[model samples]
Target: MTNVSQLARPHLRSLLMHVPDGILDAPTSVGTAVVATIGVGLALRGARRELDDRTAPLAGLVALFVFASQMLKFPVAAGTSGHLLGGALAAVLIGPWTATLALAVVLLVQSLAFADGGVTALGTNVTLLGIVGVWVGWLVFVGVRALLPKRPASVVPAAAAGALVSVPAAALVFTALFAIGGQVPVPLDRLAAAMVGVHTLIGVGEAVITALAVSSIVAVRPDLVHGARRTLAQRPLTIREKVPA
Candidate 1:
């Protein structure tokens, strides 16, 4: 058997959201850029419907939180690490449309100011994280919430479940894209298995963070949680018949 220490290990890479330059071919890069642009455009239009004086500031705060949290990466596997995606958390706190915009802003800052993600691959990152992550998480959250009791507390678990799925969903998308136009030749099966496997573990952390954040907001002000709004609004009004007064 080959000694583990004797084997040459590749440099550790954080695979949660950041897609570096040159990993994808020109066609893949350009295609994703167009898709990301269109998605952001639609998000701009959709956000108007979701945002208001009350939720606008909250949106900013959610973006900031996601930006900060993503910087904290946890080890997932040998030569790989992951971080909080925050898509489900944002969607639950605000609305999905607004959450998409929030993620875009955070990604843009990370790409430009921090150089955390490549400029060439910014669109790919946005497509994977902003569009795929946000929508998948929001859709899952909605589905989960629908199945649970219509209450503010339900939003927490629903958000967590969504978060749990979103990370691996994004990873799978990346694997597909890599298979399509990966600069480096890698077997599809191995790539898919590795990406999905590591991300599934990352998803657990995502779930925990999302649940805590959602629960905190729900406990303090359930009305402020967009995902819980319907539950709160659905509370039956108590009507009492006045007897002999």
Candidate 2:
């Protein structure tokens, strides 16, 4: 078996999931920025319906957790690293609209404060991680939940499945954007293959973490888990009537 350390070659330690400033041409960057802006705008409006006194605190906690999780990186392949995208985790724990807004906030802070992603490439990161990641994971979670038995426990596996697919879906989107206006002249097929393959590995780790966290919360407070709410709500209420003694 290949040693894990051997895969950990030294590379620039910036956020792996985030696109840097110069990788994308100006037109591509600008176009993605417009799309990201529209997505965030929609999120801002939609989140109002998703957020209430009960969920408001959880949303803030989710954003904080995602921000911290993205900072911690692990070696994936030769000279490359990966970290939690947290889109599925957020979307499953909170609603998708609130999750989108939360991810946007995390990305913005990472870009501005930590410079983890580039200032110019902020929009691309938001589009990829915030919008695409959030929605795809949410949709997948919904689909998986529908297939499984309607129980609160089902949310754990469904959330994990969503987290697994979300990472690569975002990678594919990035590959498409890169194909359009990549600063470097790389073959599209090879780039897509590499990105999808590596991110799939990363997705496994994402799924595991998401499962653990979601299961823990579901065990303690299933009510707070947005994805599991329907399953939990569908639970039949039991009432006992005293018979004549």
Candidate 3:
């Protein structure tokens, strides 16, 4: 005979700390959805080009891994928890285009099936976590990799840096959305400070997890790791050069 709201109180409190339903105006939600749809459509086309026989199965496995990782949340601050966004991890394991599709699938499933994220806010979630997260992480990874030596060992640090930066970037995106159509009346500066601050700490955890995962894959199957593939390819060339005429 317990009250339903009382029963759901704990869950609701935890849920609200992350993006939830009824927080943004209808116009904002719809606009985010339109943009997300276009991004996903483009990602789908791009993913088709990226996924070969070798990468297609790997892409599916990365999606499954990211989905599972996201479920394991850790406390970041008072009454707030954070989990792996997994965009950087996915992009490092597969390619950025496929990573976007994989992350979008994970977000869609989480929203529709588990009700982990808001159904109406699925577009926002996908846009922030899937599209922006993947691209930002991928770009950072590429930039960092370029600065580092062309070695398999370098991929881990680059992926970690990408993961570290992408979390705050996503938080900033949310802050921008709130400025547009947030249901709450909190001041923009205060909200941005809170969101970005918490996410920066969360990004530390993201960087560690991303680094560990990328390092493990590079150690075991460097050739299969999309981010390390270029470095791995150079080994054969080096061996060929060592063979004198």
Candidate 4:
């Protein structure tokens, strides 16, 4: 059997990292930037509708948690490492609109302060992880929750499934961007397959982490979990009546 330490060593060497600039043609990067800008604008509008004094503080806390969690990388393959995008976790904890804003903030901070991703590629990264990842995961979570029992316990599994699928979906979006304007000379089919395969493994980690975090929060404060809030509210109040003794 392969040693677990050997599998984990590559992740330790490289801290949190993402696609750098100049890997894709200018047109692709610019196009993605436009889309990201629009997405952020829409998110801002949506957040206005969703956030209140009570929930706004939770959004800030979720952003900070996501930023810190992203710093830890884990091995996906022999040499490739991936970190939590935190899109699904944020969406489930807060709402998708707030989640998008939260993730965008995290990415912006990482790029400007730590240089974790390229400046030019900021929009691309935001489009892929912040917008696409959050929305896709949110959709999946909603769909799954609709099919399951409307209870807080169901939120964990739905969130986990959403996290599992979001990573590969984002990977495919990256592959499509590469196909459009990749600097490297590689076959599109081969690149897409490789990207999807590695990211699927990474998705398992994403799913586990998202599920655990959501579950912990739900256990203590179910109302704070946006995805589970409706179910929580629907719960019937129990009342006891004293009988004649």
Which consecutive 10 residues in model 4 have the weakest lDDT in total?
A: 1-10
lDDT of 1 by residue, 64-107 (tens): 99999988877776766678888888988988888888888898
* lDDT by residue for model 3 (1-245), tens: 00111213332223222366777789999988998899889998988877888878899999999999987888777766778899889988998988988988998898889877788888888888888888899999999999998899999999999999998888888879878998765667766666777788888999999999899989988888898887777755533346666
- Cα deviation of 108, candidate 4, in Å: 0.6
Per-residue C-alpha lDDT of model 2 across residues 113-183, encoded as one tens digit per residue:
98877889899999998999999999999999999998999999999999999999998998888889887
| Backbone clash count, each prediction separately | 0, 0, 0, 0
Model 4 spans > 4 angstroms off: 1-17, 242-245
As a whole number from 0 to 100, the lDDT of residue 163 in candidate 4 is: 95
Q: Which RMSD values do the candidates have, in order?
A: 4.5, 4.3, 5.0, 4.9
Residue ranges of candidate 2 with Cα displaced over 4 Å:
1-15, 241-245
Show model 3 residue runs off by greater than 4 Å.
1-18, 234-236, 240-245
**Could you tell me the TM-score of candidate 3?**
0.89
Error of 3 at 96 (Å): 0.9
Tens digits of lDDT, candidate 4, 21-123 = 7767999999999999999999999999778888899999999999998887777766667778889989999999999999999999999999777889899
Q: Which residue pairs show collisions in model 2?
A: none
**Candidate achieving higher lDDT, 2 or 3:** 2
